[model samples]
Target chain A: MSALLLHALGIVLVTAAMTFVTRSAPFVLFGKKRGTPPIVLFLGTYLPPAILAMLVVYGLKDVRLLAYPYGLPELIGVATVVGLHVWKRNYLLSIFVGTAAYMVAVQWVFQGTL
Target chain B: MMKTVRAAFLTTLPVMTGYLAVGVAFGLLLQKSGYGVAWAALSSVLVYAGSMQFVLVGLLADGSGFVAVAMVTLFVNLRHFFYGLSFIDTFRAMGRRRPYMIFALTDETYSILCTAKPPEDVDGKAYFFWIALLDQSYWVAGSIAGSLAGSLIPFDMTGLGFAMTALFLVLLVEQWEAFRTHEPVFVGLASALGAVLVFGRGNLLLPALVTIVVVLLLMKKRLTREAYAPPTPPAPADGPEAGGAP
Candidate 1:
């Protein structure tokens, strides 16, 4: 088999394994009989927002502040997303407008520079 | 079972809207990255993680080592570790369907299950199973459609990837409105900022998540109790407890 295909297979397996491990950890460690420990409950209830916030940062990790564009496209794009979401309370509108704004900024306004 | 499935489908309608947009973006990006529809559909079937799949594209394009990719996958989906905690009992009772239920516990599915209430006469496990199955089907279908469109269209979709970010932000705002305590959000933001300063952008996520988990663990006493505390009941209008006529 080709190396690229091998890599793809490896990726699929590794990712699937990782997902299984993560999802089943609480179950494996605590088992079915034991009540979910307080700590686990605490983390379960609170971790969603924390992880969501981290994902936002992760999503923006590639934008370079030191570069010529200075992350303006990202900032404006996020602002559009936040503004539209808060106002219209429509997820589709917010994501569509935000993504379009970012695409326009990067493809046109910030086209010349990296 | 059909009624349960219908209700589950109804509950998953909102996620369908979100998943279609993001899943299409994933497909388009994957096609642009030089992968074909088979790879797109395969990943959606096997990995089934929207955010991590985006990261996976970058990793695959770079031809990164297996070890590095595996580590990144673990770190990216670390949050799924906790998603299953609350559902342990619910899923354990699912008999033959237990494994698939566990496998399909994506963030969106978890959210729907957390709030889902099967009609009184319906089987709860069946309802949960249908929700998960329907949600996964929507994602898989969206991704396949996206890949087909990406291959057919010649349009440049620069900046469209922000849909995932926008999705996360919208979910964050909704969580913020629902929860009384904002400590976890602050912990996440601060930890991420600190990680960025220490580890740089490319390597920030793992450390930031580690730090947030640690901080939350340390402050578990205060956070767990208040974060999900049920609202206090109102006083009776004409009782001694109320400042009204007795």
Candidate 2:
């Protein structure tokens, strides 16, 4: 209870500091300066996508070749989400359907063991 | 307007799943380490970096001093500094909410915002804003859920972490399907493989991230820009009298 508040305090402060550093450094230091090295600009521009793609791949590195030996439920759910994502290009829809599908498939078929 | 909202919401879906899974694990880790939900919620609201939050939990658990945490986190989040560079142009147009919007910027949010070139008829800034807001909201919700549900659920939430990986693959498929551009995908894979090869399992994120950035930077000139580069206007319809009058 009270402990939660204290813990949150540290978390909040750190979060704010990190956010401020990243978000404000450019505006503060540059102060609306015009010249940005093209290499820096280029790296900055593409870095987000590159970072995200890396994050995703890193996130999934643990997904097994087979769940429950076959791991069909998790595997199938992931496949379905990918399918929906490509078909609709809708992130929310795909996630919602994927989560629901994953949840449902795991519960009903695997008896929630997954 | 609705379309933009729809896109924002859609773009945030994966974010939501990733947040929930990661955020909950964070909550569990913190709680077991004697921290509380408040820390989880506030950090989610503030820091909002998925991997860093996990790292922070471990650091705190290790009882490292503040100076160590600060330095490590600074580097851990150093890439975010680069994220803002590209966003400068996009953020400037945001007007009043600029500061707050920038504060909420994360890799995932920035990725969504960066690719959004508002239709000629729409405001790109607004689209970026909504996307950022929506993504942050999903994060906030997940963080809160994780914090509040710390011990309420009995299942092993680590398995839930799979959601993040699964969601990433989904986004990858989505991007590849829509863009048909292999450059970004190739760079991402190369970086991941690079990290796996070099880092050898000691926090592959930093290496992979560096590889992606370095690779992308190296290849910037070769790739074409966005699809919305507004076609050049026809040369005054040839004045209807040049060579052959209408």
Candidate 3:
């Protein structure tokens, strides 16, 4: 069921506000004069890799290993993305090829009787 | 301004593809859930976080209470708080455009702004603003197209979602190459795997992030010391700023 217009608006607005606040919080809290605390700077300098790694995992969180084709499709898909990116260093090529590979795997190769 | 815009467009060209595909998926899913194109457009225009927008599809479909939805959105977007810390000075320097920069600091944009600098002749504000604007436009255009075409599309989209994962992986690889220290990367991977085993898929992200934080804090002496050390070699003398005009 679709949410009521009012509820949808409220949810969307709240999400927007919360997101805006979080993104701007660092700047707002630190201000321009005092500068960012060293620990905060440390996190700022270093958190990107960790966050990106977490995002990579988060992206594939739903892939099921217990299923018939298992997570092979996912594994292969990731390998293609990683391999192609490592080889080419082209972001667009890697993502397009990796996605195309996954689409083929699930749609045709790993197609389970539904 | 034109030159800066062109360079920004070039810089954001990679994100353009990812946003379009993911945005289409979002629109299709939102339409499938009974919301109209207007709703899809509004959500894309407003919420704007790619992963959170995808999650919002479910939350919207479920007709969840505002409080619950708000909490989930906060949790999903908590990392953004970290993203801003790095850009605080740069964004503050942008004066009038600072607010939009903050609002548009999505994961991909943050990644781009972290490493890419404009050519010496290009205005940094113009470059940064155009990047953010162009990226958002791609999302809006893609989502609107998908919502409009959602009902007419006939093909299976079974594994198309992996584009997002692929995007993240590509970014991870780039970050890995950029960083000299492997501690954060390893900590993130290990923490995520631990979370997967302990919390399973549904509840993994927050715990994984917390674990990374805890471990990073415990090892702060090493990480911070190494991170801020003065450059051993000469800094890149040929950085984009020095590369002059396009």
For model 1, how does the per-residue alpha-carbon lDDT over B14-49 read when each residue is reduced to its tens digit? Answer: 578667767888888998888888988999998888
Enumerate the candidates' DockQ scores in order. 0.44, 0.36, 0.52
The number of the candidate with the highest TM-score is: 3
Write model 3 residue lDDT over B88-180, tens digit each, in one string: 656766778889989999988886776565778887777888989999999998899889996566877667667768878887888787767
TM-score of chain A of each: 0.80, 0.62, 0.84
* Ranking of candidates on TM-score, top first: 3, 2, 1
Give each model a TM-score: 0.72, 0.74, 0.84
**Poorest lDDT segment (10 consecutive residues) of candidate 1 chain B:** B237-246
Tell me the whole-model lDDT of each prediction, alpha carbons only: 0.75, 0.62, 0.78
**Per-chain TM-score, chain A, candidate 1:** 0.80
Least well predicted 10-residue stretch by lDDT in candidate 3 chain B: B237-246
Better-scoring candidate (lDDT), 2 or 3: 3
- TM-score for the first chain in candidate 3 comes to 0.84
Give the candidate number with the greatest DockQ: 3
